[model samples]
Each structure stands twice: as C-alpha cells, then as structure tokens.
Target: MIESCSGIYRIKNLSDNKFYIGSAKNLKLRWFDHRKLLRKNAHFNFHLQRAWNLHGESSFEFECIEFCEFEKLIEREQNYLDKYYHLNVLYNLNPTACSQAGMLHNQDTKLKISTALKGRVVTDEHRLALSISWHKSDKCKKQNEEARKKASLSKLGKKESIETRVKKSIAHTGKKQKPHTEETKRKISETKRNKKNVNLIKGDIYAEPS
Candidate 1:
C-alpha cells in the first residue's frame, strides 16, 4: 500500500543485494513507472535495466528510504547517493542524483524537435551535453546504410573540372599504364573525326580538335 507521497526510495535487487536510490514526488506512481519500464526492458538507465533483465520482477523490493518535502527531494537523493558512492557498490545509474520525472514522445513530436534544431549554432556547452547523451547511443557508433547510399547517389554524375583532370593527370604522370587497344583507338579517332566534320559543315572548323 505504498501511497503517492514525496520521498527518497530505494530499489533493492534481491539477487545481488545491490541498491538504486532515487526520489520522486509520488512513491506509488514512480514505482509503477520503474516496474513498467523494467518489465518492458526499456528503462532509461542501463545499469538498472541490466539488473532487471538479469533478475526478474520478483527479485526487486521497493522501499521508502525517507519522506521529504518536494523542494528537498533532490537534496535527499544526493545525500543517499553520497553514502553509497564509495567502492562502486551501489547500482545507482545517475552520476549525480539530479533526475527529473521522465516524459514520453510520439514520432511526430520527435520530428518537431529535430526540425526546431535544424539550423541552430551549437555552443561548446551544448556540444558537451550532446557528447554526454550520445556516449552510450547506438546511433553514434554506426552510420545508417540508407543515409550513406543517399549521400553517394547525391554526388553521382557530377563532372570534374579541367583543372581537376589536369591535377589528376599530373599526379599519375609517372605511373605505369596500359596502351589503348586498336578498337579503343579506332573509336577515339572516329569520334574526333565526327566532331571535326560536324564543325566543318557549320563552316567554323579550326577552333576544334581535328
């Protein structure tokens, strides 16, 4: 009969006797959230998620550590965190016990968030925050295959300039190369001759290669 009350709570994994300390405005509601997330294998905290997966629901015990005013909740959570900071013993996931209640977003809201940040200039502090967020994200580890293919296709059929061609020729000047086959030579000559004939028929032939 845990009631909706502001307090510090601890989730004890009975399997390994590890503890995770947190505080919430409503003990009952927050406990329900933790149970739901763990059951779904979708908890935001990796350490807590792993524990839940390793040990099933029956192995967890939710206990009210102490009741506190809503304003002093985070402070009380931090005090509990400090007590368990030594020896890496506690399974507490937060580096600091400064957690806000989580929120859920649908796909449309996620898209809106992405659109809003489209052309914003990122400051160093923002970059650091992004680094922290992306440190454990799978998206940062690999490029999407479809995105890579789209990028490749975007550059397709782009013509190189004469300067670029000359620079490339200069770079490969001393490399060994294959001589053109007779068929290739004939095609090249025929192409040039057709261009010359076309220019001549127009009565302005000399400016082109003949």
Candidate 2:
C-alpha cells in the first residue's frame, strides 16, 4: 500500500536532462495534480507543461528526492533548486522556491500570454465560476474593495478628454441594453423601501432624503 509523505520531488525528462523541482505536503497527491494539469495542458508552470508536451509522459519520471518535514519543505526545495539552477537544467520559471504571491511575469511572457488569450471567449459557466470564486474569498473581496476605493480616489475631479469621450460614445453606439428581470426589479424595489429614500412619481424613479 502507498503511504502519504511530504518532501521535495523532481519531475525529470529522460529525453533531456531538464527537470522541474518542487516541494509538497503530500508528494503523491502533488504529483497526481501535476500530471492532471500537464495532461490537460493547463499546468501553472508553462515551462514544465511545454517540456511535458514535447517529451511525452513516457519519457518523464516523477520521483521524491528528499523526505523532509513540512516546516523544512521550502528550505530543502530551495537547496535543490540552487544546486540544479546553476547547471541550467531546471524548468522552474522563478529561481526562488516560493509561492506565487509576488511573482511577476517578464514582458515577453506577459505579451505571449496576452496574445494567446486575445481571441478566447469565456463561457457563461466559466464566468459564473470565476465570479463565485472571487466572491467566496475574503482576501479577494478585501482586495477588490481597496482597489475600488483607490480607483474612485484617483478618478475624483478627473475630466475625460474629448477624444476619449468620443471613443466611448462610438463604442456604446448601437449597443442594445439588456432589460432587468422581474426578480431584479423586485429586489431593487425592496432595497429602496428598506432605505426609505426612494420616491416613485408617475413612471420616474427618484431618491429623496428621509
């Protein structure tokens, strides 16, 4: 029976000596996740993904290099990375063995990614999933609120250039606006009633201080 373990691991391409080094809390599960993403061509490490695509799965091997405690995982992984990185055989994009919190893509990589996604259309399901994921994360919510506040502050007293206004007008010209559903209208009405500031006269909706 296979046992769960935490350690530094290596994904080696037999065709070439190039390999990716990583550390995981559960090596087996981490390797499984890597294979799944590589097979789907959606691996976060594009360098490794490209290598896997070129070399084929049969030519690669996943092996544990050192078994270490979870606390020392990053340190151990960093040592291995430092050793192999000097030889230029690593598939890792970043030389630092760390999480992707502050990783910035180079201009070339950013351009390549932008070009690749330029014509891609997000499906409604994918859009909904992204929205749900964003909403579910408190960190994301806080970041979004901060960003919005910063944007509002930055835009305060800013006037649009005539050229910019013209471009926006052209962009919106002939665009059909979707009407809100009855449910949405009902929710709006309920919110207005709760606020006690909204007034309805004839067919116009207005807000007045209560």
Q: List the pairs of residues colliding in candidate 1.
A: none
lDDT of 2 by residue, 31-140 (tens): 88788767866666667777888879998889888898887776788789779887989997666666333446566646655675676666554455446545655788
Error of 2 at 126 (Å): 19
Q: lDDT value for candidate 2?
A: 0.77
User: Candidate 1, residues 1-210: lDDT per residue as tens digits?
Assistant: 787999999999999888888999999999997887667655656677777878878999999989999877866887888788675768764435654765444566466556755786665544554455454346754556567888899989998899999999999999998999999999999999999989888876346767
Among all windows of 10 consecutive residues in model 2, the one with the lowest summed lDDT is 197-206
lDDT of each: 0.77, 0.77
lDDT of 2 at 34: 80
Evaluate model 2: give its TM-score. Answer: 0.48
Error of 2 at 88 (Å): 0.6
